[model samples]
Target: MAEGKMLEEKLFSKHLNEEMEVIIYLPKQYSPLYKYPLFIIQDGKDYIRFGKLPKLVDELTGSAQIQKSIFAFLPYKTVEDRRKKYHPDGEQNEAYIRFLAHELVPFLENLIPSFQMAGSRFLMGDSLGASVSLKACLKYPYTFGNAVLHSPFVNDDLMELVKQANPGMLKIFHIIGDQETEVETTNHTIDNFLAPNEALHNLIQEKGFESEFHLFEGGHRWTYWQPFLKPSLKYMLPAHTFDLESMES
Candidate 1:
């Protein structure tokens, strides 16, 4: 199996007035000579551990199915912290979004001079994490052009933002499950995740964004979300120019 290293780093965010951890995945064959695309995944530890993302990225890149890129995983300190940062109306929402766009992006760029192209930046997350990813891309479309959302929590406010979004500025890959009828919220409330996701899908289609929306057969869990991860990555960040035959040799 192809292998990679996860380097853990800490960034003190002035916006949130706290220190946050960032886990970065550098592929085994990574070279400083080549410019790499950046994929920022929210819920850092869960994605690296539960989602088995490093292994998946190694396989995809090893097989030349997608580009060999840099993955930066961002984890919240706690469930309460995650709720505060990821939710649209949370007290720290605006600051967290700003931190991501202004603080985190520049940190990565300066850390690796080879990390090039602002357009190659992509943000991904699940549930409320996904909601925050969409919200960030919508607000700072120039910084994050591509986004992957898995069963995002949507509301009237999010829908309003989506309606006003300039589809030309962003490309999105979104998916939700048919079985997410009554998913539990952070506040212990039951929410029909499917209805809002379906509505969001229709809105994206109507707005003519460069996007793909899929309805799967599972619920809002990592097990269901992990299987689609490769496909979603390929869709949003295609490696059409990769020479598969040469790489396999």
Candidate 2:
């Protein structure tokens, strides 16, 4: 198995007025001489722990299935902080979005050798995390080119944002469980994530964005979401083709 180096870092955000913890993963063969794509995930700790992201990335990249890229996981300080940042109606939602685009992007780009272009950046999250990722991408289309949403918590406000966005600027990968009709939320309420996700899918299609939507046979949990990660990563960041014979010469 290819072993990637993981680093822990901190960034003080002016917009959120807090120090954010970031977990970064460098590919097994990572080199500063080559520029790489950046994959930023909201709810970063969960993805690292439950999603087994680094393992999957190592397997895919080692097998030449997907491109070797840098992954940045942004974890929240607390549950309340997560709600405040990821939820559209939450107090720090706007600031959090700005932090991702304006503060976080530049910080990472300067800290690491990367492609430094919109197309080389991707945003991903699950549930409310997915909500925030999509919002940041929509708000700053030129900063992120792709988004991977796994059963995002969508609402009227978010749908409206999608309606007004330029579809040509982004590519989206969305998946929602057919059984997510009554998922419990952080606010201690049962909500239907399926319908709103379906509506969002329709809106994205209607808006003519380059997207792929799927209704999987599962619920609002990582058990289902984890299986899709490989396919999604492969689709978004395919392995770079090289001519071995020419290089040998």
Candidate 3:
């Protein structure tokens, strides 16, 4: 398979009042002449190091199993910072959501040749990162049309947001482990990720959004999430035939 390019960069977010680190992945067949879809991932470092996302994308896109796209991984500075931005009730949660929609999206679109339509943009994360991704999509469906959530940290506030959101405005790819009934949280507490995820799935279904929910066998760690990435990407970003000749005109 052809190799894709990875670049490390920093983005200054006015909302967070800080510079955030971003890892960008360009597909092996990437070209500035053709506009491609974009996937923005939370917990950027873990996704690269643990999830092996770049390699997965390389294999999938190289073999035409999924669409050739651009991936932007946003990594938080520290665990506390991650909690502040990713948790639903955290201090910077709202600001972080705004940064993703208002700042990050525009910055990437301007810097790279990407599809500007909402349908072409996607958000992905695991646990709290997944929660934040869902919130961002709920708040700004015009900017993000899809979310890939692996064992999202669901709470009442997030449930309410999903309840109030307009149906069909977004597409979601969600999965949680069947054995996630006793997962430990970052706040030193034990929570049942499975029950809440099931509730969230039912709500999403009732709300009429285009979504898929799965119950995997493992728990909440990357061991489970890493394997699901391929199917998530394939489901959310199906391969599309590009008319290069027409696009160049």
Candidate 4:
């Protein structure tokens, strides 16, 4: 098994007014001998614990399926305050993106000897967290190179972000289940979910990006995302495929 570390309250910078509790996975043969790619996830606790994302990574890493890299689930400010921080028009959106780009990136670079800016780093999330994954990639193409969005809230704001996408140095994997209709939070239909995702796929195609869109036969919940987590990790973490091969050596 590759070494996995769960750390809390690692201050990116006190001045940024940011702190993250990270779940980090270092590959089996992790060493200071090479530069590493970065994968960042939002809804940090869900991805690491509830979603079993780490287990999926461990399986792939042991099998030598991708390149070795640093996996980070950035802790939220607080559970009660997530809505204010994650929503598109929320007050903390700018600060959150800034924290990921400016603070978190540098923090990881200082810790991982091999960290690259191009074709390396990734961001992922479920629900509102997924919205910000795409938003962050669109906002900072040079900073985050890949994104995985699962059952994201694809509303007018998401369309706005897609319209703003640069497509350079960024690849995206977008997946929504067939059953995303709800009065879960709002009076939205399944079409409401698929429509925006389709719009995004078309936009990405128009922009000439490397991306994929998948619609599964399920609803908006952790049950569906948990199963898809492995594929999500593998598709985005191409380097991990190679690393897993080497780990077996």
**lDDT tens digits by residue: candidate 2, 2-119:** 2899999999999989899899999997777677889999989888888999999999988989887899999887889899999999999999999999899999988887777788
User: Scored by CA lDDT, what does every candidate get?
Assistant: 0.86, 0.90, 0.89, 0.72
TM-score of each: 0.94, 0.95, 0.96, 0.86
The model with the greatest TM-score is 3
Of models 3 and 4, which has the larger TM-score? 3
lDDT of 3 by residue, 1-249 (tens): 228998888888999999988889998867788888899999998998999999999999878888888999998788888999999999999999999988999988887887687788999999999999999999998999999998999999999999999887899999999999998888889999999999999999998999988899999889878989999998987876444324631
Runs with alpha carbons beyond 4 Å of true place in candidate 1: 114-116, 241-249
lDDT of 1 by residue, 62-180 (tens): 78788877899998888998999999988899999999998999998777533345468899999999999999998998889888999999989999999999989989999999999
TM-score of 2: 0.95
RMSD to the native, candidate 1? 3.2
Off by over 4 Å in 4: 1-3, 12-18, 77-79, 186-191, 239-249
Model 2: CA > 4 A from native: 241-249
Predict model 1's lDDT versus the native.
0.86
Q: How far is candidate 4 from the true structure (C-alpha RMSD, Å)?
A: 3.7
Q: Rank candidates by TM-score, best first.
A: 3, 2, 1, 4
Model 3, runs deviating above 4 Å? 241-249
